[model samples]
Target: MSQSTAKAAAADASASAALRARSEVARLISYIVIGSGAAFLSLRASTLPTSRWEPLGAGSFPELVFGVLAVLCLTAAVRAVIDIRKAGGANRLGTSFAKWLVARRYSFALFGLLVVYLALLPLGGFSLTTFVFLLIAQLMIAGISKKTLIQSLIAAMIFSVGLNMLFAEVFNVFLPRGVLFAG
Candidate 1:
């Protein structure tokens, strides 16, 4: 092969290896996080109160589910660790993590929006809070333009107000009313 072609091929291989290493590291992180959460829940579930009358206690189901989840997470974490070690032990973890943050910037923004939406739900009211959040999130993702703005507003109104009305009137399930709208 030509020298230039051979160098290009080597570069491609290096890039592929780096991508693989990053993926394994990300998997390891996810497994660790999920495992910790599962373990905590399992422990909490164990201390829950049981029922006297019924054969199965209130905590029985939760305990079983969380225990199983914890075990599965542990198993997955071990496998991820093995993969990471084989891929050279996450030496580039910081680099991969920084790249991940940049790549998923929009996802982080959406999560932030969700947190705000939930926090303001009680105070602002469900419909209003949801409507504003939806409109903003949609516009943030889809970008602002004349057509998109109108469409997103329509969509936000329909989903926010329609769901509230449907749940309250049709399903006879009332959502939490905002303190502002309580009176």
Candidate 2:
């Protein structure tokens, strides 16, 4: 066999392997449809008790929003299934176990970041915690760049201070201030 032919065969094998690693489209479609139906039913069946603020008695807006989301999810699921069928196994599309594995690989780091940030929040206050979290997040996701590292740290400080003031003063939403301000 010629070198070109061998390279072509190798490429085809790799493509096939990648396709096999992907999730089944039909299963994804079924799950999405069932999940949306359940969400729709739950929202529709939810009862809101009488409250002075709600003249029509709450649960009205939530149910409407949920119904809309259900319709959207259902439509998306149907379209995905149809597209996959049209592709005739040429395209591996849908959220499957393989995709979940890939997503988890990327997202697990976020869980750790959240844990550290929350753990430090009470001890370091919002500014310090925000700075550390933002820096770590930026570095981890994008890799360390001197400019990006400095910018993210500064931006975190600005955002945390501004948002903290806005919530505490303007909205009267008390955020944890730690023991720094107590003394």
Candidate 3:
């Protein structure tokens, strides 16, 4: 394999081992969140009586989503445990996991951006949030460039406006407009 590829593989192995060594704590946390979410939804569902069109009433959607999330978390816990068990031996992962870790660097930035977007939605409108998110994302991956910044800002504006219009006008869904809407 290539030198970079080998280095990535080594990095992945080390990261996986480190993550696995702490799997028990991670698994416990996942179990708590997933279990609580699932149970809350389940209880909500039980409190609602069956309807003509929908059997589970208002609780069905949240319950279904929570149940699926719980199952996925449970699966993650199982895999983490398995990885921890097999980490010592020679049975290591190939390039797939290594490449995934590399790609996750960008994905994590996107995740942080989303968190900020959601948090700031109540303070600033979608347009402002999108502008900041795009600028930061572009800066993180490829260093600052005037052209890139302009393009990103324009794209962010279009996306934010388009999505806002679609959700508010077409879908009739309410989005947080922040203090701007109140004034």
Candidate 4:
């Protein structure tokens, strides 16, 4: 083969290898996230209160939902494992995982925001806390723009106050009234 042809072939091989490495890392992260989420949801559903009046009880719907989620998660994990095996099991994942995390820093930032939102909920009240969380999350995910900012504000208001009112009036479910606002 010509020297140029050999160099071109080498470059193509390098690019393909990089792509495969990224795909494997992505699959590993997905498997971990789905598996952990399923476990958490299942445990949370188990803690829900059961009603004596209903055969299935209050916990029934949550349990059913979480059960379905768990099944889907398991299915995805199995598929990932199969794919990994087919790709010769690239098991040296530590460096790739770190690179993936750095590449997707926004995801970790959003997760931190969610944790902060949960922690501040009781102290800030549902309406205020949810409004702020929605606004910030929307901005982070969608990026900043005049139109987006306006829409984000409206959406945040609707989700926070409107949903709260709907739940309290229609469903008769009262959301938490923060310690600051509690009568």
Highest lDDT: give the candidate number: 1
Worst lDDT run of 10 residues, candidate 3, spans 88-97
Q: How close is each model in CA RMSD to the real structure?
A: 4.1, 7.0, 8.1, 8.0
Q: After superposition, how far is residue 63 of candidate 2 from its true place, in Å?
A: 23
Report every candidate's CA lDDT.
Answer: 0.87, 0.70, 0.70, 0.84
Best candidate, TM-score: 1
Q: Candidate 2 — which pairs collide? A: none
Tens-place lDDT digits, model 3, residues 138-174:
7777777898778777777777777888899989986
Ranking by TM-score: 1, 4, 2, 3
Considering lDDT, which of the candidate structures 3 and 4 is the better prediction for this target? 4
Candidate 2 residue 35 Cα shift, in angstroms, is 14
TM-score of structure candidate 4: 0.56
Model 4, 29: alpha-carbon shift in Å? Answer: 9.9
- For model 4, the stretches where C-alpha displacement exceeds 4 angstroms are 1-13, 22-94
* Per-residue alpha-carbon lDDT of candidate 2 for residues 86-163, written as tens digits (9 for 90 to 100): 546535454445565675775888888999899889978886677778778877887778887887777777778878
Q: Count the backbone clashes (under 3 Å) in each candidate.
A: 0, 0, 0, 0
lDDT of 1 by residue, 4-79 (tens): 9999999999888877777777777887788788878878987888788998887788888888887888898788
- Which structure is stronger by lDDT: 2 or 4? 4
Model 1: lDDT to the true structure: 0.87
